[model samples]
Target: MASKMASCIFCKIIKGDIPCFKLYESDKTLAFLDINPLSRGHALVIPKFHGEKLADIPDDNLSEILPVVKKLVAATGATEYNILQNNGRGAHQEVDHVHFHMIPKPNAEEGLGIRWPQQKTDMDKIKALYEEIKARM
Candidate 1:
């Protein structure tokens, strides 16, 4: 079974089952304007391959996606943009497939922002966690 939703909005866009304002496209990547844009030039760049998480995508597919994103920035004449890729439900991933949000931020007030609660980290626990990760690696 495919990890991606057959009826997903992105999938529809990819399959040309739905219309989109395309900015750029290559053999392995597609860049299109966000249907529900956060800003004027908000767009998403995604791999042609269906993968729920970034790491699930093969390296070549991952590699192809970003150049399309860069091209979009140049094409839009965007002075600054934020590249975002959220993973899992805890990270506000509305879509199941791996995609990069390239949101143009012409001004401070025009783009993505979220309130994150910062907490003090325990150095001892951090060290232990790092050790565990290193051991697994």
Candidate 2:
């Protein structure tokens, strides 16, 4: 089965059933300004094929999403940007499908602060972590 949403909000936008402040598009991909943007020109890029999660998507379909994002970043004149993807309810993924949020921070914009819980780690433990990953290889 294809990973897609018949009733998904994005699908509606792609189908032109809903309106979006669009910036760019191709036969396979769509780019539009996020309605509730983190900042101005915040855009969402998605494949026409809808997938609930990243692993559920085909490689070629996933590949098409980013080049469109790069084009938006350059067109918007954003010097720095972030590509954010979320998955699962626990991950704060409000949208179920695989889409990339391209957030641009022009010179005047304040960078979003990531709130991370603090944890203490010893050097030996950190080194053991690297060794463990290497062992898997």
Candidate 3:
């Protein structure tokens, strides 16, 4: 069995140490409403198996969460939604446990509205980054 971080909040919720407004639970996964929700039905889908980053999770565990996200979007009458998962501090991942945010975008202006200020950079720099990442893979 894979090891789970004992102090992780998601692990605590899975262990029933903390209470949650539970939405769905399976033998290997759990879906619960986010306490600091972006919208009325903003939820978090997490694997019962604890992992700090997406790369740390097994494919089978990671694969099970999307359906739950869909289920929530439909139930909430969300016209659109954003499925976001962040890794590491640079990405603003407040929680160390790997989790996906299913933020329902009911309106265009509210609930985690995004403004991407696009910056044009040199193509050589971008190509170098791509090559560096490809080498690691």
Best by TM-score: 1
lDDT string for model 2 (96-118, tens) is: 77788888765455434356898
lDDT on C-alpha atoms for all candidate structures: 0.85, 0.81, 0.87
Instruction: Tell me the alpha-carbon RMSD of every candidate.
Output: 2.0, 2.9, 2.7
Instruction: Give lDDT tens digits, candidate 1, residues 57-95.
Output: 899888877677888888888888889999999999998
lDDT score at residue 33, model 3, on the 0-100 scale: 93
Taking the tens digit of each residue's C-alpha lDDT, what string does model 3 give over 1-137? Answer: 23447767888899999999999999888999999998888999999877789988999987779998888888778888898998999987988888989998778765777769999999999999999999999
Best by lDDT: 3
Query: What's the C-alpha lDDT at position 7 in model 2?
Result: 66
Ranking by TM-score: 1, 3, 2
TM-score of 1: 0.86
Off by over 4 Å in 3: 1-4, 121-137
Off by over 4 Å in 2: 1-4, 107-111, 117-137
**Residue 123 in candidate 3, Cα distance off native in Å:** 6.3
> What ranges in model 1 sit over 4 Å off?
2-4
Looking at model 1, residue 32 earns an lDDT score of 86
